[model samples]
Target: MKGLIFVELMNFMEEQFGELLTDEVVDAAAIPGDAAFTTIGQYPSAYASRLIGAAADRSNASAAELCRAFGRYLFCRFEVRFPTMIQRYPSARSLLMHVEAHIHEEVRIIYPDARPPTVTALEVDDALHVVYRSDRPFAHIAYGLVDQCIASYGEQSTVEWCEGNDDSHARFIIRSLHRSAA
Candidate 1:
């Protein structure tokens, strides 16, 4: 993780946890009650806290390398129904599988040319799941995901639409809602 993200994490922890960190900050913040649960701290249990919310070197590090790092992190966290298809891009795509319908569309709106997931009844979970990268040009997706979800749904949704690129290569699920009976 970059020094900035580490520092920001510290400040974020203090703001959310009601106190600044110290020797026991790790334990106190990592506890189930801390606001850290809402941030990158959620992944520390799996050793992913090292790389969850930092920028790769614009100096030398490539996006693919960063995506791979993120992939490794998420693959260890989420239980994928289609692991093979998703195993390739855990950091970038897998986290998107559980998004709610309308919020997913709002996330797409964040990207100018981005589209939402094609809606499907599927085996279960009729909700929409869209993948919009969070960093780079698509960084606005993060702003959209959080803002729109709060606007359309409520302030309680924890779903995040963050990724590692700016250019829009968005994927969405578009399905019509109607009555179908035998």
Candidate 2:
């Protein structure tokens, strides 16, 4: 977890979720990212801040351990209210329970503050419509992944190439993925 992410998430609470938040909860939530932030992940700083918040509470419990416990609690079930998550994940705590993705450095720069869209489904037609935006680029890299995920999971589906979007995404379909224009 990053201080930036925690702060940004906190700021987003007011802006997007219409809620007041505490630093302690955010701090307790930052441990899982400690091992591979820059090399393999993007939220180390935020995790660190979360740990600091956790550490402040108990002398017997380390922030890391507290965070581990928090992680367990998060996955078990808690009400975390965030307005923008479409009512599925009600808060940051709840969002933490469900969403898990590795950020792409290329797109992360443009939407660094944003979390990747989790793919509940991929509806592919002339365009690649992803249930989770983070799963969008995979539409090009391997349509089979989308096919397997959605069809196997019973989502309406197809895999076809589209044009536009600064070529950031479409280019992948054409250049590396051998996708034909629709």
By TM-score, how accurate is candidate 1?
0.23
In model 1, how large is the Cα lDDT of residue 101? 48
Off by over 4 Å in 1: 1-61, 79-98, 102-169, 172-182
Backbone Cα, N, C clashes tallied per candidate: 15, 19
Query: Taking the tens digit of each residue's C-alpha lDDT, what string does model 2 give over 1-182?
Result: 22333443344323422342333344355445322234233553434444334443533554433333333332222123222332453322223233333222323464556444343322234333433233223222123333332332233434444455321132112121223332
Lowest lDDT sum, 10 consecutive residues, model 1, at: 173-182
* Model 2 misplaced stretches (Cα beyond 4 Å): 1-5, 8-58, 69-81, 89-110, 113-182
List, residue by residue over 57-139, the lDDT tens digit for candidate 1.
Answer: 22133434444333333323222323443344333322344343433354456443344333221222533445454323332
